[model samples]
Target: MATADAALRDTFTLQGVTAVQPRRPDGGFDWDWRGPRNDPEWAWFFNRHLVFTDLLAAYQQTGDVRYRDRILVTLDDWIAQHPAPSGITFSAAWRPLEAARRVMESWIPIYAALRDDPAAFPPERRARFVASIRDHALHLRNHHAFSGNHLITEMLALTRLGLTFSDLPDAAGWRSYALDRLARAYEDQVYPDGAHKELSSHYQRVVALNYQELLDLLRASGQEEAVREWEPRVHRLWDYFAAIMKPDGTNPLNNDSDTESVAALLRQYAPHIRIPEQTVRLPWAGQVIFRSRAAAAADAAGVRGSGFGVQGSANAAAANNAKPRTRNPKPAAATPPPLLYAFFDTGPRGTDHDHADFLHVSLSVGASDFLVDNGRYTYTPGAFRDYFAGPSGHNVLLLDGLGPDQGPRAVTAAADAAGVQGSGFRVQGSDSRFPSPAGNPKPETLNPEPAASAAPAVEIAWGDTTFASASRPAFAANPRAADWRRLVAHVPGRAWIVVDRVITFSPATLTTLWHWSPECTVEPVPGQPDSLIVSRSSATLHVRHAASQPVPADRQQITARSRPSPQGWYSPRFNMLEPASCTQLDQAIRAPLVNVWLFSPAALPGASIRISADHRIVVQLDPATSLTLDPEAPGKSAVTGTMR
Candidate 1:
């Protein structure tokens, strides 16, 4: 309520920017006043009118007439100061996304609260509010969002407005157009496995929230038939979010992403979607989030093989005539070990929030992030933007592009610094070409994924320790480009191994990065230059890199919050930045180079790995348990591990 009171006084802080709006001679607030930073984001928030919603909620809770009157005054001031947009423009006050958000998330709710109060919300003000809503709808009708999550967002607002104002002359047209576009946009943006195509966990949450709201609206208004059509998709979106959750119950900061509340989203739709919670592999999305199962308890609980882990075919039949789970309950442990969670990305680079993070992997021990991607720095395209989106921000092999010293490159320019731009996850938006409406076929990507969001053509091998592999074709325009392949296995609570191989047709340089959480302290293991011990909280992780051959010592470096050349940074929020530690290895590849990274609680004193004549990697975890990783063709899923 204090925040609401401050906002009412024209003192506002939004998105980390704080400023007091100047009062006019008539004591009215300046609606167009941007904060000191003059950030477009701040303006977008101010115009969203979310503060009004907060004031309304406060009034409802405390029965404060001041809060209610604040809404009337500020809203009247806003409508008077800002007129309808002349055309589709990105002025601070009239961006399409914010406009949509203003009505759907803020204004409509405010209107409902004040509509019955004739003195508080007189007929003239009500008419103006409705008129502004019509203008917002007209502007959103022509909006196209780079074929990104914004498309669905704008359409969602239009749909909501049409449904709420059914008596308006244009309401019917608004509903029909917005609904058709939303259905098509949903198809374009969501994968069959339920992952949002932009591939950002933050955006996935945004898209899911929008859909679930639409679904709830449909259900509440007796739109039963429409409800039936949309329920499964909403369920699938939430399912993917559930699969990718860390032990802390939040999604990984992959691509251009930020942290979002996982439980709040689930609370709305989880019960309606009932799918067994376990390790999941979404092949169509080209990703796998592995949840290590307790071996003794899992097997005893009738755990069947999913091809992602230990194959159970040798001991069982395909029939489900096994003992009931209630009868064969899992045994309890006095103290359970912390489960290891891993998020692997080998899919498309996404259309809008594209990141050069192919074959990237994020690891977490319990709730602690060990190997992390420095989400996105900012979308404004600066040094931080390049570093956060390029090879330096993720745990992957960098091929002949951005090296440890290449400073200040944009994502597009980084393509030259690093040769593989848009190599993996062949994005359908070729060079920012979004797919046109249903009948317009000319704008489709050169090689769009099999049309319609269906199960992937080539699926992930499901198991206890899931396996996924991807191959990035040589940079088409670079003669020195190399064909690259990455095969990874998450041994659940055990360990994780990544096999990276590059076939260089010509001389090329490479660098490998292993990003660690800022809380982590990394140092080379005594007398072992090829290994490092990373300590975070009370836990420790040992990371070792062994190439097909040896790498020179001079090529390895530890860059921590350094300047100019290499970047050592992380972003916990959209506009926030913090220094972090990073491990980088440089190399010069002539013929071929294959590198292996083994991450575990600790490396066995005598643990050894062998590379075969056929390029298969075999690691002896101990005398009894061994893992053999065989690389497969790109876009094909196959089981390659012997253990779960």
Candidate 2:
């Protein structure tokens, strides 16, 4: 109501920019009221007309006719100013993505609300409104996003136009064309394991929402056969989102992602949703979810047959529905919080939303995301643009500051990145997810290699606690690109062991980075040991480097919000920045190097280590979590651990 009242007075704030968009002397809206020219996203976001939805919602809530009047007047005036196939103009309202959102976010909902309100939408005006919707649909049909999440949403909106207004002449054609495209897009955009191709948790959510909306529309439009064909795969999309989610209810900021929460939405349909495993792995996406829910508490309480792997308890339906809980509560000594929720991205760069953070891991203890990624700061190129999208903005390896083979198509400041992947920012790409099946047109032309061409980045055996990934792409373009492999293991109810081995016969500078959440307080251990106590709220994680594979004292330093460099910074969301702890270890190496980072439940005790001359690593964190990593360990057996 406040927002609608504000809109009535011609004041609108969006994307953190507030402006009083007062009506003109003639009481017509000025469609070109650009607020805050400092950020490039302002104009683009403003043109989407999502703000107009607020007015319609207000009218429905209060039954205020003036709120209703504002929606109609704004819609009519905007339509009058910009004809279908609108000419190139400063408004940027005709951009197909803006058009798509306007259709889904603005036109469809508002039209449904007021379509029968003849006092507001009389016959003549109603015909005009519907015609404008057709124009938007036609524009979208001809000119759509080249590819990526935006394309999926646009197609869904187009399909919506066809179904909602089936009475229209070309509505059937619109639905038919969009349905075919959407089906093909599903095959291309999603991996075999159900992770979205962009590999961004945020974009994955976006694509999944639109995809689900498409399913809902299909069922509502009396297309039960089509719904049957799509439901399973569509559920897989939801499955990935549910898996990679952090303990705090948000997924990691792996690629171009926001700290988005899907817990509440998932809870509403808890009974129908799948309960995530204690450890979830999407092999195709090279993602591993190393987590411990109430299972640890169950073990301590001698609670048997809690059905941890089967059905989810009622509480499980909420909070990403990640963990299954106990149906009957046994009196516990204390309220046992969830433990060690981590998202390890041991995968290739996504086809879009590519952050150069291969081998990146985000860790959350209980409710706090103690370790994190520098999120997508903004789509605009300046200040933190390259930093947020590049290797420095991530937790990964850098050789002489050279990152993953970004390829020639890497987004540059001079390049207009729209047609590339919707994000004009530099993102990691050049990934070949799952191979296309026979008789399928290769997914996106922007991706050069056939999906089958690239080697598997990682291998996993669900029965085993340890798995390894070889990030060959990370070193493919480097002078010393011979070796890049990492092993990640969950130590039951104990610890997570991450081991990285890089071979560099030639002398070069190797830098390894770990980006921590801004809320975390990282204090170095009070000794010569290379360790830190990472604590946030009541959760504390002990982090240490193996003594055998140690970092030199003089070579390590911590950075926090350095303006001269994009290091030590984190983006909670787009256009938001905060200082974060980024630990960088630089070592000048002329031989093969092995680095082991151990994160345990309690403060890390000194661990025994043995590195043979051939680079075989034998490290023991505790009795239950000893690991032997051979230099020639195949992708599947990257690390042989004691648990197996």
Q: What is the C-alpha lDDT profile of model 2 across 181-210, one tens digit per residue? A: 999999877876667877888888888888
What would you estimate as the lDDT of candidate 2?
Answer: 0.64
- Candidate 1 lDDT, tens digit per residue, 234-274? 87788776667775666788778887667556655674433
Q: Tell me the alpha-carbon RMSD of every candidate.
A: 9.9, 8.9
Model 1 residue 484 CA deviation (Å) reads: 1.6
lDDT of each: 0.65, 0.64
